[model samples]
Target: MERGLTNRKEVAKLAGVSEATVSRVLNGIGPMKETTRERVLQAARQLNYELNAVASSFARGRSGNLGVVLPHVPKVHLFSTYYFSELLGGIGEAVHAKGYGLLLLFRDPSEAYDYVSLYRTQRVDACIILGSSAIDTERDAVHRLAEERLPYCVMDQRFDHPQLNIVAADHEQGSYEAVKHLIDKGCRHIGFLNGSPQYSNSGDRLTGYRRALSEAGIPWDEAAVYEGNYSRTSGKKAAALVYRDLERLDGIFVGNDRMAIGLMQGLRELGCRLPEDLKVVAYDNSDAASFTEPPLTTVKVPFYDMGKLAAERLLRVLADKASDPCPQIKEKLPTELVIRKSSGN
Candidate 1:
């Protein structure tokens, strides 16, 4: 009935299975049959049997923990961001369902951190890296982890390594659809406010934007493209840079919802009308996008789903290592176009 008092013998007796079966089911080691595994698990639940994590880890040579790495930035709130919060929520759900512990760590971009050390130190059985950039030091760390053949995954980032696991959204297609929607609205001379090139998604969005223009027989104007930092302030700054040619600009495609909202605010202050003067579309379908003055039409990226998939893929990798090696997997999820009043639709 109690933690220390309940033993495997009683569990096996209740489930009508051998003690070894109970051990296998509890430790998640060895192959298991469906009906037998369920019976053992149910008996354990009914008896409130708790396995000794330390003993099991010693036997399995694992920590039974998953590592989640995030970037540490001064003066920045991590959880408040819509993107990271959704991602964490999804990862937490998957980790809980698998009955594994989560170890969250943050490292400064300017400093050095060895990702493979987590596995070597027995702190985590696997790792998931989030919010990756094209920084040289970060790329080096990823390469080191891959070279060591560690079980890990990177969310929303892609590397050229054949063995690296990646889960990301199809940003290029999403961007193309958003731009096409704007073009369908008879909006010509569309301006673009894009994020920094450090992230691959930013580059993909740029490619999609150019492709859409080329398909529609519109000339690409270098002066109409403004680079933003995926922030509201940057969006406001982008508005000023395009203001001199605002008269000729009929629509705009922003990189993210935060920037889209800021661009709206900037346009309002600059004596511009919504949808009537300048139609707008953005990406990331964040919560604030819906509550804007005229709800923004944006690309809805499945961050939560991608996080869950990444965690699931990492768990599979850890399991496969016990028997045979698993091949590297790269999954690209699709996005949806959420039309709202901001795009005049």
Candidate 2:
């Protein structure tokens, strides 16, 4: 056997621990009891073990890799979507420029969120999370990470954790401006089509919609609010409800471009004309938004910038913790309302 390998095995045997434990103790991966760490070190000394440069670096608890945790939805091509593509582009740019490796980790929303395992296993030094919601399991996982003080950031998600570093867009302001724009265009009875209830941004949009109606002196109608899963199919399904209330509604504020596109298509198929019958505004300002029959008046969110900022901030801390040891950054970037023919502008 090679001398280094023999020394490693001997040290593990002398310490009465597995070889994996000896490797972890030497590499500083995960959490280890002080007694176990001491025993491993004493065994290494007895065997006259010497660590190479790479092993020494690992022993210091840094893997020279930045991890990005993504939601693993079956059959969902995340890279093709504008939201995911833009965010990944930004994150990729930051990691590349920083001379650090980018590690992709996928987690099923249905399964347990074990983000700390990546840190403990020495797979990555820091990480960024995407597609998180208000799920209780997610919240508990984040709380555990917070307690550990692991370097990580969550993009475009809001949690109850006070110590979490989050970079998210101002969806409330965006939704408010969308509805307010419709109101300014003489829409007295406007309807709002929102995304899933699981997302925090969904609540923010609803709050904005209500605020706009209250400020405009328009009576809130329970039927005016519609729900969708942020998919074009849901938007198409919502068209039936919108058609039923077509006579009462003069405008609609949609949560996203995909849903808005579907709603418009379904309404058009049912002989409802855009702007002529109902003015509409949407969010996300996706690439297809501009190509709609009547170009969509949508809210443009800074998702790319949000991803970039989150990565840069977290990487900066990893590079120099002494400068900014505890990064409790909470930022909300502004969203812009783009005017187009759909809003009757």
lDDT scores for all predictions?
Answer: 0.83, 0.85
Put down candidate 2 lDDT per residue, 1-345, tens digits, no spaces: 124667678989999999877876775555678899789888887767764522454455666688999899988787777788888888888988976788999998977789989988888888989888888888888888877777888888888877887889999989999999998999998999999998899999999999999998988997899999888889999999999999999999999998999999999999998989999999998889899999999999988888888889887886553543456768899999999999987
Q: Model 2: runs farther than 4 Å from truth?
A: 1-58, 323-325
Candidate 1 local lDDT, 127-225, one digit each (tens): 889888888888888888877777788888877777777889999999999999999999889999999889999999988999999999999998888
Cα lDDT over the full model 1: 0.83
Question: Among these predicted structures, which one has the highest TM-score?
Answer: 1
The per-residue C-alpha lDDT of model 2 at residue 3 equals 40
Superposed on all Cα atoms, the candidates' RMSDs to the truth, in angstroms, are 7.1, 7.9
Q: What TM-score should be assigned to candidate 1?
A: 0.84
Worst 10 residues of 2 by lDDT: 51-60
